[model samples]
Target chain A: MNFPELMGLAFVGLFLGLMLGSAFYYRNRPAPFVRQIPAFGRVRRAIGLAVEAGSRLHLSLGRGNLISTRSAVAFVGLSILDRIARSAAASDRPPVATSGESTLAILSQDTLHDASKFMGADYDPLRGQLTGLTPFSYAAGAASLIHDEATGASLLLGSFGSEVALITEAGDRTESLTLAGTDNLTGQAVLYATAQEPLIGEETYAGGAYMGAGGMHQASLIAQDIFRWVIILALLVGAVLKLVGVL
Target chain B: MKFPFSVAVAIGIGLITLAGYFLNIPVLQTLRMALIEWATTLAAVALLVGIANLFTIHWNKLTSGKVGGLYSAILIVSLVLTLGVVGWFGPTHTYSKWIFNNVQLPVEGSLLALLAVILVVAGVRLLRLRSSMLSIIFIITAMVILLATGPLFGISVPGLTELRSWIAQVPAMAGARGLLLGIGLGIVAAGLRVLIGSDRPYRG
Candidate 1:
């Protein structure tokens, strides 16, 4: 392999080792406490409020193609979906999940089904919906769905584009709470400006862990923190070396 | 041992795919390609399923005398008519192209325009929503960029253009790269969690 490939492989290996070690060790103990993130707290509160109000909750999983790396962000959305679906199992109005991708739609349906099954109920396939295929199309579809359902809150966590503003605007019109995050830079920027509670940077990926998905999710955060410092240190050292002409 | 079949399958596929990325084995490459193909096919099929679900929901809304029944009816009619027309003719046919160019394109364009307006509104509203030092800085930077994007009534201001470019290229790019690094690590750790079967997002 070339230098870049070799380096990438090494990095991946080191990450895997660190994550596995952390997950194993933390499994038997109380997982590390997650830092305070209001977006996640809003999600939990939104679920509870939607249930109590007997109003619908909208979860917009942006069109993240599963065959690609975008699926990682979409998976985080599904993880949140699983949690909310389970949490609101007994509510009259269950949460509605809208996605741009068909695969995400299916996984969302499966997530709702699993949650329903765990709660001894049947899931409505219509709840986990594929709204549209393209970016704006997805945004337009999800925006309308939000208004149509009279959603009490909107949790937009996925791989959206700048069109995320449309969904957040819908939430604004409805006066509903909006907590949004995405891996797309444009989406993140638009959401930061528009979403009621914006999750910036790595905050979007930390959703599952913050939501208490499982010990593994928490472990992933730990691994991320450690490796992040390692990268920062590497960058700093390289910068210093260059400054000193020591390369 | 009580084995979880689905978990095992997921983990196995994940491992093979992960290995394929780092290793140069012909057998692993072929397996990875096959798995990816299967995934693509499944995604396509899932699209169909998603469409069916959407149709079902609208159908239910129409028949159940819901408040939005008429809109749902119009949507269904439009959907069916478009599908029938497009299917009858090849996707590249004139009729299909006309529908896309005239209908879908315009609708998307309008939404895009609305998005621009909404973003500006949101930007202005940011101060009212949460006035902080960061918000102040964001507004100032945004105003500077917008004003400096072009000359003031065709008069180029000295240094302002350079200032805008520097802000856009330097601070913005740096912040973006920092976020990207964090996002990359997050994806890695999350993917690893799934690969190790500690996180099963697909179980349902």
Candidate 2:
């Protein structure tokens, strides 16, 4: 193999090691260092209410791809999805998830369908609703679904763009409870969403732990906190060095 | 645990890219370019998966015969017909560009226009739902933004242009930037968490 290929192999090794190590590390930790926040409980309550009322729990995996590590927001969104799917399964009413991306959509269908099967429901894999690839088109499809009067509680988690607000705004207009999280930088929609709705921060990845999806999610949150602090420190040092004219 | 060497290579190339960007090194740039080419090749393969998934989905939708089944069939027919025509006729063919310009563009454009109506409805109703100070602030700001953005109003008052520009540029820009920074940090953290394998939603 060439030098570039060799380097690529090493990089993948490092990434996989980091992921697996974090998973196992958190698995072994005693006393659960990650704290379960109240927001997750609220989400749980909303799902419970939807099930009781015979309404649907709407999940949108906002246009996120797992290929890039930069899509942490989407990963957090995925955690929420796991929480919601598990909750929905426990409830009498099943949940419905939607995704715009093919990969995410298929995975969501699989996850939700599996949850239903676990709950002893006749599991027919959900044929996902892929509205469109464009940000606005995806938002429009989600908005239309929410307006269908059958929608109970809507949870949107993923890497969204300016379309995040459109989805949240639609939920607001409807009577459905809405929760959205996105890491799309240029998404003017999220800014609009923040102004109007109750959104969790980047820590939505911890939603599984926060909502008590067992020790796994909690450990993930702990790992995330450590990494976040490291990033902050790095940024601070870089800024300080620039200010001091050291480089 | 065995790993996909291709995926590993793609990620390695990406990391080298980060070093290249930060350090301004020639070697890093060379490595990054090579990595990008590999990624492009992988992407082409991924696109095939996407196309196949789309075809399978539309075919299922067509067979279901429920509400919107016809629409699904229409979508499939359009997609296949367009592809078939393009395959036979080549790029510069009148049919290919015509199909894109007439069918795809209009459908996309109409969806955006509809979003405008949705936005207005959402804005107006947000005011009624909550008489809270924050809701009021949101409503007022939205109205200011809407009016300021309008061509007719902007021409009538020079200050409208300035105010609209400020709403779009200053508060809006700052909020977007802060949100973006937070998101970027979140992405990095998430990537680290994944690398650490703390949260494997993918593992089922």
Q: What digit string (tens of lDDT, one per residue) describes model 1 on residues A27-137?
A: 789878767997777778878889999999888889888888787888888888888888888999888899998888888888888899989876788898877777887
Q: Score chain B of candidate 2 by TM-score.
A: 0.80
Once fitted onto the true fold, the runs of candidate 2 whose alpha carbons sit more than 4 angstroms away are A1-39, A52-54, A65-70, A90-93, A109-123, A127-129, A143-149, A164-174, A185-209, A213-247, B1-43, B153-155, B164-170
lDDT of 1 by residue, B87-161 (tens): 999799999999999998998999889988998999999889989998889889988998998558988778898
Q: Tell me the whole-model lDDT of each prediction, alpha carbons only.
A: 0.86, 0.63
Against the native chain B, what TM-score does each candidate's chain B reach? 0.93, 0.80
Interface RMSD (C-alpha) of each candidate? 1.2, 6.1
Model 2 over residues B1-204: C-alpha lDDT tens digits?
Answer: 445554455445556766654545688878777776775676556555556665676677579765556766886887689879899998679998998899878977886676567667666665665567866776777778767766663367557668878888988786666555555545654565544444444454
**Winner by lDDT:** 1
Q: Which number leads on TM-score?
A: 1
Off by more than 4 A, model 1 = B1-3, B150-152
Task: Write down the DockQ of candidate 2.
Answer: 0.22
TM-score of each: 0.96, 0.72
